[model samples]
Target: MSVPDTQVVVVGGGQAGLAAGYYLRRQGLDFVILDAQATPGGAWQHTWNSLHLFSPAAYSALPGRLMPPQVGEEYPDAEHVVSYLRDYEKRYDLPIERPVRVAGVHRDGELLRVQTDSGTWRAQAVISATGTWWRPFLPAVPGRAAFGGEQLHTVEYRNPGDFAGRRVIVVGGGNSGAQIAADLAYDTELTWATQRPPRFLADDIDGRALFDAATARRRALDAGRTDTGGVASLGDIVAVPPVREARDAGLLKASPMFVRLDRDGVVWADGTRAPADVVIWCTGFRPTLSHLAPLGLRGPRGHIPTADTRALAEPRLHLLGYGDWTGPASATLIGVGRPARDAAREIAGLLRA
Candidate 1:
């Protein structure tokens, strides 16, 4: 019946949670960040070895601290990003509790009760910034379970060396699929498959251009003007040096998705069979909202309706870093800061009132 009380309970310690904590501290609110990861880097610690930010270090930083530059690296790798996050936490002295996995959250009269592996916390508001890395999604293909080949999601992929000399199939049209395919192509016979052809940005274009285009579109819409189409989307693949090189070498081609998986390989829609020794799925991820199921806010598709970052069904609940549904580009490192700040301001106002 009793629980520790706080002004706000931020249920993640990744970029989104850190950004929220930064703004909450500036507002002088008593808040605690509960992170599932034992380490300080959050999900960045688990990314693939070759994964690099499409944006420069400065552009990829969270609020309050600039990601320090790496020597001779245009885009910081996963390790560098993790190190920066650890340094950011130390610099701000953000109050974070690690290795605390939230199990569920529900209404406790006028307050929200957070149930976690460690203990319970009753807070005036809750910010769910858990992000999507924990829930890598793969589409269901007929006979998939019967396949004898090695199947792995992007989460489990570490390096190309493990797949050397094997016939590999990289699935998905997003950045992860392209990058992983490029990485594997050098050491293995690789084939890329997607629902459709992957769109590639211009050689010179990168995350900065995508962010700018998104910003301009949003501005036009806010002013009741028709958005000028043709702006690069956040999901569009950035033509990184490696990806471009792969394209130039004719290694970045995508095949239409197969109809089903067989014992030894996949059967394409045209009934062509391609032998694959390993299948790596880079499809995408869903929001990690299992903790919020008790609230009955999720829709049939497992999405919670949100007015910006605030949950429509529960105003005291704010969701961040899930994806565009929560806010514009809320899932990205830089894109998350804006929504985090907004959520903090709203939470502060509610507590003050």
Candidate 2:
């Protein structure tokens, strides 16, 4: 079919996508953003009802808005983040086509052909902003079928209220695991297990985000040409001292081990059998790139091969909202502006070229 032409087509409506769209608008590019969700907030709306962002509100705003300090005094819940994103869309007059899933993307000579559930769009350039959260990694576990318990990944989790009377086994030990375990143990039997001890850091030390420490290590790795080296898992990111704090507060019981899963429940590395009514895996996410799989990815892992300086692998194709989306500055809304601006310049070049 002959597709409608556009200067640019942005995939994914998450923060990165929005930022790219806003920049695209500033550059006067004729573009439309395609998002799978009905609204603009992306997956943040699907987060647990009680979920509050760990980053302060000030750090959460997009390029055009400013979240207040008052909002940051405490964590902003899922709803607040959604409201802010909606406001961003309104301010920019962004042309985001909702619930439009990108079915396929390919190079049709010079133009990128984007076929969505809604229709097809041919763009001179395309921004694959489908943030990294599209896929959830659930490694194959032996005897998983045997453990007839309630199994769920963190994405499906709403809150701990439903877990009031159940023995919940929260595994993987990421922030979700820690927070969920802390809340659930308040009213039910809980065990927070990790394959290895995670690097636990203070949420804020004198107003500094703990994630900065991990970022520093990552920067060093990148500097040493080890961007794809054996990076630490969730447990490795959790430091020892704060982990003790979790144990001392009775928020979690240290079960530094992994066991087999079966109909009976989980069996720990130390040979302890814990009968769990629910198993919540707090394991992290996989970059959702299913639609882009046929695009001839140039990276070793599933990621598109992006040069150290560029966020796109080929002409008319770019990516934003990656793991190191913008570096230590990633922790602040301030960091988003520069990258968005850079993306805007690149999109402008495409429009002009």
Reference-based lDDT, each prediction = 0.88, 0.70
> RMSD to native for every prediction?
1.7, 3.7
Collision count for each candidate, in order: 0, 12
Model 1 ranges off by over 4 Å: 1-3, 220-235
Poorest lDDT segment (10 consecutive residues) of candidate 2: 229-238
Tens digits of per-residue lDDT for model 2 on 301-326?
Answer: 66676643144557567766665543
Cα TM-score per model: 0.96, 0.86
Whole-structure CA lDDT of model 1: 0.88
For candidate 1, lDDT tens digit of each residue in 1-353? 34579989999999889989999999899999999999998888998898898888988989988888888899889899899989999999999998999999989999999999899999999999998899889898898898899999999999999999999999998899999999998899888998888888888887777666765676676689986552444446888888889989998888999899999989987789999899999989988999999999998678998888899989999999887667666777888888888899999998889
Number of the predicted model whose TM-score against the real structure is largest: 1
lDDT at position 239, candidate 2: 28
Model 1, total clashes: 0
Model 2 TM-score on a 0 to 1 scale:
0.86
